[model samples]
Target chain A: MTKNILLSAKGLSKSFGGIKAVNNATIELKSGSITGLIGPNGAGKTTLFNLLANFYTPDRGEVIFASKPIHQLPTHKIARQGMVRTFQVARVLSRLSVLENMLLAPQKQTGENIIKVWLDRKTIKKEEKLNREKAMSILESVGLDSKAKDYAGALSGGQRKLLEIARTLMSDPKLILLDEPAAGVNPTLINQICDHIVNWNKAGISFLIIEHNMDVIMSLCDRIWVLAEGSNLADGTPEEIQNNPHVLEAYLGQ
Target chain B: MLNFIINLSNNSGYIVSLTILTSVFAIFALGLNLQWGFSGLINFGHIAFMTIGAYTTVMLSLSGVPLIVAVIIGAGLAALLGFFIGISTLRLREDYLAIVTIGVSELVRLVANNEEWLTRGVQGVRRYQIPFVDWEPGILGKVIAIALLTGIAIFAQWQLLRGIKNQFKEYRSVQNKSYQPTKPIVCIIWGAIATIVILFIYINGIISLYNYHYQAGLMVLALLILALVYSGLEILVRSPWGRVIKAIREDEEIARALGKNVFFYKLQAFMLGGAIAGVAGSFYAWQLNAVYPTSFEPLQTFNAWIIVVVGGAGNNPGTILGAIIFWTYDAVTRFLLPQLGIDNARLSALRIMVIGLILMILVMWRPQGILGKKEELTLGK
Candidate 1:
């Protein structure tokens, strides 16, 4: 079955003090598909994610999300536009409870408005009850329901990654940019995450993942994009990329 | 009742005045708590709002506006100042906000000092309208006012007793559930403190019935305002709006990634906190009986910080407790230090040194402040 493009970045470039971090890199994500971004250290893979999400502005580029140009928008605005990204180190509010971390992700919260917090308390309370129930169910799915009352800081490294991904689900995103979801995570947990991602993809959520685990990437990604030294080296099916000489050379070095 | 209060006031006027000062500073530090404790805005120039509120309210009252309306306007103007400062610095970084706020407060003080036509220069503004100053209550009015004061005193005592009872109940319940040999020392300490506080309030209430003057009335009003503000803030910090700000404080990037407008929320906390401090400034001006340029000093801002740090940054009750303890120290030292053979200048310096020592010890041992939770302490982290 054919799928339409969900996100497209054209001619993206960024430089810091005369060093081009991401040079003329272009990538696309199809709706209802899992895409992989793979590169060696300092190959500008993370920089590309930052640019696409508007964490860092590109000197020359236009990004279209769901058929709308979002490069000019703020990072929060882009996330509100149904695209969210996660950090490589799995950032969580250490002081907040695990349930609160999930509760913070929903957009257009009535209780977030200061005046409504006091004036329309009944509605806010109802909304809070609904959000809490939803958060609990999501936590239960990830087996984090038992630790909902615990601080996010107390979670294991792998659990923190899962929490971060689960938090994005609360925002109802169409596309999620996950930065190294499998990095530093134990092998058993990595497979568990891969399964969750495939299930989420089947439920119509698109993903762009960066991973050092080649087995996880090749098995999960429908298509792959390779970056080397701030430029795109190859883009193809996993089997094609595995056979491509340029992709092998970029990883092994000449 | 009036005669009884007047006689009692003859001996305890100093304590009554000190309580007024503590209450005003508590209100001031509460505003700082909302900004720094909960939102993590790093507002070092909190006194600027106080200065604006005092000057604006006094100037407006002198020009014939109603006292309450003048105070409201003062708070509004302070919030406006917050808006300007927040727009410029909130989008940048916390350290930048700190530098800008400190500089802006200094700028505000300088303007008050130089703008002779507006602020009357260093001489300061005097003889503004004091709230409830002109009322000459007859016999019936005095009886009603005394009765009201007595009723409030009784109510406060009842609450304290009930609180003590509840604490004991919970203590036993915890032991039953956990089966641990938990010590009762903390509970006993709390009960003793509550008893002392109850006795203090009763003494003040009895004295105020005789005094019945503007200053005594101001103390009651100030305490009432402090209670209201504290309760309001308590509710706010537990709300979803507060959750967003707490999130912003810990990691704004995560908040932004979750689609929250981080800059907007920071600006809101800044303006609201400034507005609260402005209200505190009005109470301060009333207590001082004059609004002076030197009154709003950089040192005054640090006084609020000391109260917040000593009490607990994120806890409202802790801020109030800090203010009470701090002012009690000031009052005690004022009389005692002079008797210790030290000159006025040295005595003042020594007082500050002692406070500094206490602060250092508290930082090392009880870094979360007296009332703060051990696990939730985020200082320096």
Candidate 2:
């Protein structure tokens, strides 16, 4: 496929002692594309995601994000470069309210000088107003507008998922890697989440989603990459992947 | 009727003195409360900050610097100590921090005791300049000076509380979680505290200025204010930052993942709290009319912790309440213990024994103390 390269991981291999968790796995995430990574448990799909996001230093790999080599960068530094990831289990700042949860995500706020915040009350009040307006609008986009007053912990499982998505959006991400976005979500909420992914894709934010739902995997992903036992099984269109005998065998424990 | 009136008036001064002294300790407790109650920074060496405040004021005063400058120096030293303590420990985990802190406070006491040149060795610094003493003219002057100090302190506290409230309001979550800020409720409470502080100062000033008996009345009024000061401290910890501390207490790693920079916030809170503890120490110095190295012992810091845990670990109001109840019982016991079956030396030991037993019982049965949330009490389970 002819595409602008957004992130390319070459010769990625990592091991714990004698165990090769992710061995010589390489993948390319092209710009403006929704990609699917599917595999059974222990397939190193999440591990690969971790390595790609710079959470773990790969034993050997080169991660090029936004055309810069980011393998040695810290996780937050990687996130600041517009490549962010969401964990499988939703982690929200439980103390802050839902709105606060969203606001804290966009740590790029420039107006929050502690001295200026305390001393110059007027500037703080004005900044606060503007920040609130922006926060509310973003909350509206994620269907969490009404829950702005709610503590983050009080949100339901699906809402927390939406909150995680909202949090990533607050970072104004160019690319997102979701590790099991629809794992515990109800079907209806899962559809809402899928719709959001599709909408974000339309708005030019690319995603690499690890989804267990076969229907979700087949319908949305522009291209699919299947992994088996820490190795790439196949990479193709969803239809081509579904028809591939190798993918069938991998699923059937061959 | 005249005799009774005279008796009431004498007792009222003692009451006032008690209030002022209590206020000083209450202020110390409040600072400690903010550290323990809001941010969960285990500041075991709280009185070290207090010692800094006391020694600074006394040393500066003895050196012939103006009293205002000395007070400022004292406050500055306290804040400096706070900054140092905060930087050293706020990064590490809680228990390790606590152990180090307990050790650090004792080291401060040891330094204060041994350093004869600085703290006059074990004897401490005396003949320290008192605020508004030269201004203690007629009844009105004394009254005015006391009122001015009280008013200024209450006002500064009012402003400080306002800033804290604004910080709380920035990310406030719950309804009953009322921050002790410039809210109408807080205003009314401050108003009441101001009234009491003013009344104590005004009344004491009148008698002392007229009768030419000043020093003792000041001590009496200082002790009476123990409740108000700590209660105010309790209120701040119930604010949003307080909740953040509790969140940290519950699961700090989660707080970190949410981009809260749990370490930094904890440090800021720790320093602010230490500064407050310093203020308390200074205030105690003021109450005592002289500061000695022996006064800022580790026992004072640990005593505040005992007050916090015995009252309730995470509950602010409970600790304040604990302070008043404990101090009053302490005062009564100090007087009554000597009268009862115990010798004078053993009487001191009894207070320690009683404090230990109370702490032990509270830990064994009601680990969360009186007002704390159950989760605030940590067990390995």
Candidate 3:
């Protein structure tokens, strides 16, 4: 609990019409820790993730990543600042090959520029070779190396989920906010995903994971934060959170 | 046999003209491919770019600017317009681009139609000097140019094949336990056939058969431009830049999440497509020997779209084939319908109807198009 803060959101709030989706929600992700965010459906967990990642601008909040104010930064700018997020439904480019999806995730690719792609052909090709090697190694780790040439649309739901996580490795981010990584995934893959998360955490990549599945949260999360009705309900270790009365009441009420 | 040969040679000028037209449209559709096919940017006003290109080139050249400078400026202007349009609309949903582009295109047409001082109004611009118009190439000169262009085309094809083989070598080897030389062999055979055809055509003095003295030079120019644009697009589409554009097309949010500036890539694609269209516009103006406000009508945009759709949205070879098919149908129907006693107005309508029917059938049975890969289409369904 005494770890250095990697990312933190303060006094974040957003509203749609008359409804306050996320109100005064504050959260912190410690460096090299696997944090879990849990709530019932429509508890504004995703909304909070959006705010933290700058996908949605908060009405009144400040996000600091690596001690730099990032609330004003765009989503891509925030990502470049060493924090990235994945969707609840894995948003892979289905038309592209699995390897293409991986290759697209890296930042600052020289070939990303139209002029550079033509003018800097040698540099681009060299960089691409290096990127492909990195992507293949990452795909190997996720057991998707064989499907590198396959269209991503051909992937199963679990494999797409695995690919989503694998893609984040290409960016070499300090923190990754995963939105419902275990949702709709098969049990075996769920275990595998948790194992990968643990391994990634051990390798110095911090994670803030949102999961409806309590088993994944209990096993993988170092500490858990519970949201109820767009506000913080409880925060503690998995054991303490399980016994928290308000957390139990909120889930029961839902 | 002698009469038949004479007749074929007599109509060869018309054939060359038709070929030039088809190649110009192929270039147009290639631009569309970069925008809609690869980047998923909807540009219903693509004709606007073509208009900007053609008019700018003609206007500049007529005002005493060098032909090459005029063409470069024309393309640059079109690209600048594309950049502005992209900045204004790319941040919104995809349909906004379609709407804005169509409106802008119509606005450009109207401006060209009414502006007498700049564009000469409805009278249109005519007889601007095309590149190499003064230099009447002899048979030997023509053959040399043809050979040089063909050599570039073949080298481009070989490089493409080698790149594909290198990129997918591991996957292919893994999929098929034995490595087959099928792809390279096929490519080499095709290259050889192309070389023989070029040599045969040039050696037999077929190039002299065109009635118009400028026809050979213009055709060669068009072919050279087409080859350069096609190869350029092929390289870009296979590069890392292309992957990012495809990713943006698939899901802008995901691309942004991965730290890519989605707007930036979209703008780049739009501008590049516009620049290519501008180049096509210059060729088009030369083909007709005129630049009319009516020529850049909305129908022109639809023609390019139809070509792209029929050929294979993302497939460049399919686009070229689609252009050839479309123009051949148009030419054949024009002659046949008149011979069958149809008036000009009715024949035109009927021609459109036939195209519509063909498109309908294609959509129903093969929406991915003649050469399009099914997996590449990002259809919602």
The per-residue C-alpha lDDT of model 3 at residue B147 equals 74
Residues B1-381, candidate 2, lDDT per residue (tens digit)? 677447646766565456556567666777787777666677878888888777777788778988667766776777777677667877777897888778878888888889887788877677777654554466675565456545545654564456446545743544443221224464456446645544544455445434544444454344334434444444444333444455566556444444345666677667766766766666677767766777777778877877777667655555655665567777788778877788878888888898788778878887876545443233221
Model 3, A1-254: lDDT tens digits are 24398888888999999999999988987889999999989999999999998889999989888888999997888888888899999878888878999998888888888888779999998998999999999999989998887778878889999999999989999999999998899899998999999999999999999998999999999999999889988899999999998898889874
Ranking the candidates on DockQ from highest down gives 3, 1, 2
Q: For model 2, what is the error of residue A187's alpha carbon versus the real structure, in angstroms, after optimal superposition?
A: 2.3
DockQ, 0 to 1 scale, candidate 3 = 0.54
True contacts kept of 2: 0.07
Highest-lDDT candidate: 1
The DockQ-derived docking category for candidate 1 is acceptable
* Residue pairs that clash (backbone atoms under 3 angstroms), model 1: B5-B210, B6-B210
Q: Could you give candidate 3's fraction of true interface contacts?
A: 0.70
RMSD of 1: 3.5
Candidate maximizing DockQ: 3
- In model 3, state the lDDT of residue B36: 95
Pick out the ten consecutive residues of candidate 3 chain B with the lowest summed lDDT.
Answer: B174-183
Q: DockQ of every model listed? A: 0.44, 0.26, 0.54
What C-alpha lDDT, on a 0 to 100 scale, does residue B117 get in candidate 1? 89
Cα displacement (angstroms), candidate 1, residue B240, comes to: 1.3
TM-score of each: 0.92, 0.76, 0.92
